[model samples]
Target chain A: MADTSHGAAPGAESAPGMPQLDFSTFPNQIFWLVVTLVILYLILSRVALPRIATVLAERQGAIQRDLDKAEELKRTAQDAEDAYNKALADARSQASEIVAEAKADIQKDLDKAIAKADAEIAAKAAESEKAIQAIRDSAAKSVAEVAQTATADIVNAVMPNAADAKSIKAAVTARLKG
Target chain B: MATEEAGNGFNIHPMDQFEIKSLFGGGPIEWYSFTNATLWMGFAILAVVLLLVVGTRKRAIVPSRSQSVAEMMYGFIHKMIEDVAGKEGLKFFPYIFTLFIFILVSNFLGLLPTSFTTTSHIAVTAMLAMAVFVAVTVLGFYKNGMKFLGLFWVSSAPLALRPILAVIELISYFVRPVSHSIRLAGNVMAGHAVIKVFAGFAGALGVWAALPILSITAVYGLEVLVAGIQAYVFTILTCVYLNDALHPSH
Candidate 1:
C-alpha cells in the first residue's frame, strides 16, 4: 500500500495520512467546536441548570413540609390522648362521688326505718301491759263476789231454822270479819 | 510500515478511518465545509441537547432514567468542581460541564462501529486543552495579579534549590497543555487503530478469525472503560489547573 501510494506525490488526495495532522482542517474543527461549546454553554446556563436546581430545591422543600406535617399530626394525636386520659380520670372521680352519695343516702334511710320500727314495738308493748292490768283487776272483783255467794248458800243450808235474812247476813259478815 | 509489509497478503488501511472526508461528496476540505468531523460533532451536540435539555424537560423531582442520567452528570461535575476547585470555582461549572459532556459523548459515540471519533484528533483535543490552558492562565493572573507567578516558585524548598525547582515547575507548567491534549488523543487513536487492525486480521485469517475477533472484543471493552476514564481525567485536570489559578499558593 505504501509503494502503491501514487508515486511520492506531495499533498496527493489518495494518500492515507493521519488526518489529525492535517493543519488545514484545524480552522474548521476549531470553529465548529467553538460554536458547539458556546451553544452548549448557553443551553445549560440559561435553561437546564436552573431548571434542575429549582426541581431539587422544590423537592427539598416538599420533604421538609411533609415532615413538619407529620410532626404536627403527632402532636395532635398526643393532645387527643391527653384529653382522653383527663376525661377518663374525671369520669372515674364522678362515679366514685355518686357511689359515696348513694351509700350515705342508703345509710340514712336504714337508720330512719329502724327508729320507726322501734317506736312501734314500744307502743304495742305498752298497750298490752294496760290490758293485762285491767284483766287482773276484773278477776279479783269476780273472785270476791263468788266467795260472798258461796258463804251465803252454805249458811242457809246449815241453819234452816234461822229465818231472818238481815240478821243472818249481819252474823255471817261479823264471823267472816272475825 | 513493517506491519504493512507483513499484511501484504491482504489489504488493510487502519489509519484510513481517521481520514476526513466531505459529508456531501468528493471535494477539498474547506475551512467552512461540512465534513464527517462536523457531522459527529453535531451528533455530540444533539446528544447533549437530548440528554441535558430534552430529557430533563419534565423537571421531575423523582427523575426518569434519562433525566436521572442527566442529573447524575450534573451532580458528578458539580461535586468534582467543588471538590477540586473549591466553592468559588462553582462559577465555572457550566464551562467544565460542557467540556465533560462533549468529550464523554464524543468518546462513547466514537465507539459505535463506523462512527468517527472526534476526540481522537489532536486538532480537537488540542483546542480543548488550549482553551482550558488559556482560560485558567488568564483567570489566575486576573484573580491574583502578579502573585500567580508564585505558583512556579517553590517557597517550601531550601533557598538554594528554589530557583532550580521554579525552573522545573515553569517547564512543567508550559508542557501541561501538550500532555493534556496528547494524552486523550493518543489513547483514543491507539485504541481505535488497534481495533481496526485486529478487524483486518479477522478478515485475513478467515478460518481462525475468532482469535482476532475475541481480541477485538476485549480491546473494545477496555476502550469503553478508557472512554469514560479519559473524559474524567480531562475534566479533573482542568479542575486542578483551575484550582492552581485560584489559589496558586502551593
Candidate 2:
C-alpha cells in the first residue's frame, strides 16, 4: 500500500507530458483567462471598438458628404455654364437683331439720299431747259428785227424809187415767213 | 518525454518547456497562483491594449502606422463577423474580438524562443471553446426556444431516415466544442512539438545539425502562418456558431 501510494503521489506531483492534460493548473489558467478576457471585452466594447467605429463612421460620413457637396457643386457649375451659354446666345441674337436693324436703317438712309439726289438732278434739268428756251426765244426775236432792218436798208439803197418803207418792210416780212 | 538520447552523447528534452510551474520560483501551484500562462496572457492583454487604446489615442483622420494597424485589425474582425453572421452578430463583436486578438497575440508571442504558448494548452483552448458553445447554446435557446432543437432535426431527409439524421446531427452538435478546442490546441502543440523535435535532432547531430536547423526555420515560418490562420479560423467558427444560434432552422 505504501509503495503504491508513493508511486501514485509521484505520478500526480510530476507534471504530465501535456501540461494541458494536467488538471492541477486548469483553474489558474481559466481564472486569468476570464479576468483578462473580461477586461479586453470591456475595453473593446466601451473604448476600442467605439473609437474605431466612430473613426470609420466619420470617414464615411465625410466622404459621402463631400461627394454630395461635390455633386451639388458640379451641378451648380453645369447650371452656370448653361446660364452663360444662354446669355451668350441671347447676346448673340440681340447683336444679330441690332445688326439687322442697323442695316435696315442704313439702307433707308441710303435710299433717301438717292431720292434727294434724283430730285436735285431733275430740278437742275428743268432749270437748264428753261434757260435754253429763253436764249432761243431772244435769238428768234433778234433775228426777226435784223431781217426787217436789212430789207429796208437794201431796198432804199438799191431801188431808190422802187418802193416805200412800209411796202418794203411788208415784202421783207413775207419773204422771211415764206 | 523530457529528454531522449539518440545513440550518441546528445541529450534532448523537447517537452520540458511545456511544464507549468509557478512564475515566482518552483512551488506547489495553487488554484489562484500566477504562472507563466498568466504572465503570457497578461502580456497578450497588454499588447492588445497598447495596440487598440494607446495606438489610437490621437485618432488622427490620417492615421499613423500604429493606428492604421489597430484600425486594420478592427475592420478585419468587424467585416468578418458581419460577413459570416450578418449584422446581428455584430452584437457579439466584443467577445469575438477579444478571443481573436488574445489568441492571435498569444500565438505570435509563443513563436518567440523560450516563450510559453498559452494557446497550446487544451485547458485554455477548451475554456474558450466552452465559453463559445455555452454562449451560443444559450443564445440559441433564448432566440428560438425549443425550436433550437430543430437544428438537429432534418426535415428534408426521408421520413424513415429523419430520426437517424437527427441523431447524427445531435452528435455533431455536441462535438462542436470538442472539435473546436482540439483543433486549435492540437495544431499549436503539434507545430511546436515538431520544431522541438527538429531542435533535438540538430543538437544530437552536431556537424550535420544544419539540416534540422534549416527545417526549424522553415517550420517556424509555417507556425507564423498557422498562428494567424488559427486565430482567424477560431473567430470565424465562433461567428458561424453564432449564426446558427441566431437562426436555428436548418
Candidate 3:
C-alpha cells in the first residue's frame, strides 16, 4: 500500500537495463499542442506574416523608387550636360560670326580709306604742280624786271651817257638771251 | 495548471509527476509536465513576439534600426518561402512562419533556467509534427485532388515490387510524425537533463567546487546554442515538409 501510493517506490524493479514505456500521459499535452499550434497559426496568418510581407514589399518598393530616382537624375544630368555643350557651341559660333563680321567690316572700311587717300593724294599733287609752275614763272619775271630797272638806273648815274647805257642794255640783252 | 486528482473511478491518477494518457482511439500515449519546459516556452514566445512587434511598430521612410531588423527577418522568410515553397506555393507563408517562430521560441525558452521547455515534451512535439503531416496531406489534396493519391504508388517501380512499395510508403507516412517529434524533443529533453545532472554536482561537492561550476557553465552555453540550433532544425524540417507537400512527386 505504501509503495503503490508513492508510485515507482519499492519492489517496482523492471529488468535492470530496459526502460518502460508509459502510454497514459499524452492526452493533455496533445491537446495543448493542438491548441497552441492553432493559436500560433491564427496569429501568423492574421498578423505576423502579413505584416512582415508588407514590410518586405515596402522595402522592395523603396529600393525600387530610389533606383528610379537615381536613373531620372542621371538622365537629367546627361540632358543638362548636352544642353550646356550645345549652348557653349552656340556661343562659340556666335562669337566667331561676330569676329568674322567685324573683320569684314574693318577690311571694307580699310579699303575705302585707302581709295579715298589715293584720290586725295592725286588731286593734291595735280594742284601743287600747276601752282608751283605759275609761282616759278611769276618770280622769274619779277626778278628780271627788278634787275633791268636797277641796271638802267646805275648806268645812267655813273656814265651819264646814252652810249654807255645802250652798251649796258645790249650786254644785258645778250646775257639774258644766253 | 494543477490537476485535482485528474479523473475519478477508472481514470484517477495523481498530478505531481509526468504520466502518459490514452487518446480516444486505442493506442499508447504519454503526458508530460510543463514544470520547467513549459515555462521556458512561454517566456521565449513572449520574447519573440515582443521583438517582432515592438521592434517593427514604427515604419520609417528611411527605416529606423528596428525596422531594418524587421525587414531583414521578413526578407529571410520571403526568400526561404520562395526558394523552398516556390513562388506559387507562398500562400502557406503564414503557417510556416508561425511554426518557425513557435518552435524557435520554445527551443530558446528551453535554454533558460527554471523554465519549462514544452518542446521537450514528446506529446507537444508530436502534435506539431502531426500538424505538418496534416497540412502537407491537405496541401497534396488541394493541389492535385484525386490525382495526389498517385504519390503513394511508385509507378516507376518494378510491377512485381509495387505492392511492397505502397506498404513502405504508408509506413513511412505514419512514421513522419514520430521522427519529427522525437528528433526535437529528444535533443532538448536529453540536453537539459544532462545539464541538470551536471549541475547536481555543485551541491554534492559543496564548498570545494570550481570544477562543477566550470562544467555547468559549459553545459549552459552548449544548451543555449542547441536551443537556437534546434529551432533552426525544426524550421528547416518544416520547409522540407512544405516542399514535400507542394511537390508530391519527390
Candidate 4:
C-alpha cells in the first residue's frame, strides 16, 4: 500500500499512508474540539444542569406534599369516626333515661287509679249493709202485729160474752212470754 | 489510490472515510478551517441541546417520555460520579457529563452510513484524555498537596519492594492518558473499519455477496453495543481517575 501510494501521488497528496497520522489536520480537529467542549460545558452548567436539578427537586417535593395531604385527610376521617361513635353512645343513654322516666310516671298513675277504685267499693258495701238492717226490722214488726190479731179473733169466736180486746191482748202477750 | 486500482482489481479503501476534508471546498486545512470534524461536532452539540434543553422545556413533574429519558441520563451520570468519585467529585459533574454526552453522541452518529467518526481519530480522543489527565493531576496536587505522591508509593508492600512498586505505579499512572485515549479511538476505528471491509467484500463478490452481508449485519449489531459501552467505559474511567485524584490514599 505504501509503494502503491508513493508511485501514484508524488508530492502534496490528498490521501496519506493513514489519514489518522495526518499532522496537518490535527490543529483543526483540536481547535474545534476545544470549542465544542467549552460550548457544551457552558450550556450544561448554566442552563441544562440547574434545570434538571430543579425539576427533580420539585418532583420530590410534590410527592412529599401529596403524602402529607393524604395523611392529614386520614386523620380527619378518623376524628369524624370518633365523634360519630361518641354521639351514638350519648343518644343511647338519653333514650334509656327517657324510657325510665315514662315507666315511673305510668306506675304512679296505676297506683292512684287502684286506690280510688278500692275506696268506691268500700263505700258501696257499707250502704248495702245499712239498708239490709232496716228491712229486717220492718219484717219483725209486721210478724208481731199479725200474731196478736189472730189470737184475738180466736178468743172472740170461742167465748163471745167474755171476749175483750184489752183482756185478750194481755193474755196473748203473757202466753207468748211464757 | 484505491479508486485508481478499481478498474484493475478489487477496490477497498477502508481508511478513506477517516480523511479530514474541508467542508466548503478543497484547500489546506487551517486551524480554523470548518471541516467535517467541525460539522459533526456541531451535530453533537445540537443533539445535546435538543435532548437536555428542548426535551426538558416542559419540566413536568411527571415527565414525558423524552423528558424521562433526559432525567434518566442525568441520574445515571450523577449517581455514577457519586459512587465512583465520591461526593466531592460532584463539583465536576457538568464537565464529566459534557465528555460523556459528546462521546456517546459522536459514537452513535459515526455508526450511520457514510458518516465520519470524529472520536475514531486520535486527535480528538487524545485531547479528551489529556484534558482529564491534566485536570486530575492538577486536582490531586491542589487537594492533597505534596501528599498526592503517596498514590504511587505502595505502603502495603514489603519495605524492600516499595521502590519497585512505586516505579511501576508511576509508569502506570503516566500511561493512563495514552491508554485511555487509544482505547476509545482504537475500538471505534476497528469496528467501523471492519464493517467497511465487509461492505467492500459484499460489493466485490458477485454471486456470494450474501456471506459478507451477513457478517456486516452481525458486526453492525456489535458496533451498536460497542458504541454505548465505549462511552460508558470512557466516562467511568474518567471518574476512576478523578477518584484517584480526590482520595489518592492508595
Q: Per-residue CA lDDT of candidate 4, range B112-215, in tens?
A: 99998999999999999999999999999999999999999988889999999999999999999999999999999999989988888888898899999999
Which window of ten consecutive residues has the lowest lDDT sum in model 1 chain B? B1-10
TM-score of each: 0.81, 0.85, 0.72, 0.82
Candidate 3 on B1-250: residue-level lDDT in tens?
0122233112222121122222244353334444233344456556766767766666555677866766676677667878876886577777777777787777776566765577777767777888888888888888878777677788889988988998998798878888988888888777777766556555556675678788879988887888778777776777776776777673
Question: Which pairs, if any, clash in model 2?
Answer: B2-B13
Q: Please give the CA lDDT of all the candidate structures.
A: 0.88, 0.87, 0.68, 0.90
Off by over 4 Å in 4: A1-17, A110-178, B1-8
Point out the worst 10-residue segment of candidate 2 chain B by lDDT. Answer: B1-10
For all the predictions, what are the DockQ values? Answer: 0.48, 0.53, 0.17, 0.53
lDDT of 3 at B46: 64
lDDT, candidate 1, residue B166? 96
Candidate 3: where is the Cα deviation over 4 Å? A1-25, A127-178, B1-41, B62-67, B152-170, B204-208
* Order by lDDT, highest first: 4, 1, 2, 3
What candidate 1 gets wrong by more than 4 Å, as runs, is A1-17, A111-178, B2-8
Task: Assess chain B of each prediction and give its TM-score.
Answer: 0.97, 0.96, 0.77, 0.96
What DockQ score does model 3 reach against the true complex? 0.17
Question: Residues A1-178, candidate 1, lDDT per residue (tens digit)?
Answer: 3443533246566555666776777888888788878888888889888877787778789999999999999999999999999999999999999999999999999999999999999999899998998898787667555656676677778886665566655665666557
Q: Write the per-residue lDDT of candidate 2 for residues B1-250, one digit (tens) a residue.
A: 2232535556665556776779786687886888998899888888888999999998777789888998999899999999989999998888899999999999998999999999998889999999999999999999999999999888888889989999999899899999999999988888998999899889778699999999999999999999999999999999999999998876
